[model samples]
Target: MPTLEDRLRNCTRSAVHLEMRDEYMPSDPRFTAWRNGARNDPADSDPERRPWLRLVADLVAQGVEVRRARIVSEPVSDYIRFEHHLTVPTVRAGEQVRWLPRRRASGLALPGNDFWLFDGTSVVFHHFAGDGELAPDDEEFTDDPVVVKLCSDAFESVWRQAVPHADYTLA
Candidate 1:
């Protein structure tokens, strides 16, 4: 099986990420630091310091439109607030981001898991545990047309209703 990096590298047109969880990877050092009131310097775009930012930058440079949408619960979690604060560099790196309050997502048929859809073809599902940590054997990737269509449609639906990151606030 091709690695996720390999798949992403081969993506030509778009890479869309849909994130629905309120909290993620609590044990992650970055989150831990945020929990302690630490904040990321918006001026820091050093790929060495943040590899994911590097990836998003490279993909955008390649003309791959990278976008992310988060459906968050209102009275947002601390982690979500921290993520919003850190999103500046991510947007500056060229990834478009939006936030959707979960209450507004009532009628949409969303997927069971968060996922990244590449070029409308491949999908990478992120499974998480009850505590919101990534599942032990997480990252599931597939090219099934059915799953791809569902995720693609779901993402678009959410994106259309989401607020652009800069305008969103925890309510």
Candidate 2:
């Protein structure tokens, strides 16, 4: 099986990520800083500080349309708030992002987990623990059309109702 990085590197057309977790690893340094009242300067001059930015920019240069959607509970978690504020760099790197309040997500038949769909042909499902930390070595990738289509459909549904990051505000 190809690594996620390999899949991403080889992806053509579109790459979409759907994040459905309220909290990820609280121990991550960035999250820790946010918890300590630090703010993210989306306009920070240094863009290459993060490698993902380079990868995203490269993909965009290749005409790959990258997008991400998040489903979060209202009265949002602190981590979600942090992530919301940090999306600017992502947009600057040539990706579109949206946010969907979980309340608005009811009745949708979403997948059991969050996933990244590449070129609408492959999926990488993220598995997490009960406390919301990612499980070790838990990324499951598949090329099965049925699963891919289900994820594609679910993502589109959420994307349609989701608010663009620039317009989204925590309530």
Candidate 3:
């Protein structure tokens, strides 16, 4: 028989026993997929990702005095009108707001298989293994998945490359 490591390295279609979940809660034990998105990628997009809507509603609901920044740009440039609802607040909702300045900022680095996002909650870092290997169970995963580790390292490198936020004048 092949070594256990070899068997686990190619977990292309295996399932692990785990707690019942939302069936799409991400972090599912048996899910074997990866992509370039936030650390928290729901099977369907979540409204919580729309920080702009939450901000506006929160401002009106809580009536917290809001000084705003109104510049939002996505280097990917893939967000649509519905997504823009959140993009606006993400662009404008903080005492200290900063957007990822990839295509615009001077000295921006090359795109890698990693991304970092801060939503005034905590810094979330995402690293994807572009080598296209499926992630095995934490209990069963083997191969050290060095490509994924490298992706995580690349995320740290880019986080260091981030520029400080500048206030928007909202012209």
Candidate 1: worst 10 consecutive residues by lDDT?
A: 38-47
Instruction: Give the runs in model 2 whose Cα sits over 4 Å from its true position.
Output: 41-45
| Deviation in Å, model 2, residue 119 alpha carbon | 0.7
- RMSD, each candidate, Å? 1.5, 1.7, 15.4
lDDT of 2 at 155: 98
Per-model TM values vs. the true structure:
0.94, 0.94, 0.25
- Write the number of the candidate with greater lDDT, choosing between 1 and 3: 1
Point out the higher-scoring one by lDDT: 2 or 3: 2
- Predicted candidate 2 versus true structure: per-residue lDDT over 1-171, tens digit per residue: 777778888988999999998998887787888789877544332466766777889899999999999999999999898887777887888989999999999988899999999999889999988887779977998989999999999999999999999999898
In the predicted model 2, the residue pairs found to clash are: none
lDDT of 1 by residue, 55-168 (tens): 888999999999999999989998898788788888988999999999999999999999999999989999999998888988998889999999999999999999998898
Clashes of each: 0, 0, 0
What's the true lDDT of residue 120 in model 1? 100
Best lDDT goes to which candidate? 1
- What residue pairs are clashing in model 3? none
lDDT of each: 0.89, 0.88, 0.31
Using TM-score as the measure, name the better of candidate 2 and candidate 3.
Answer: 2
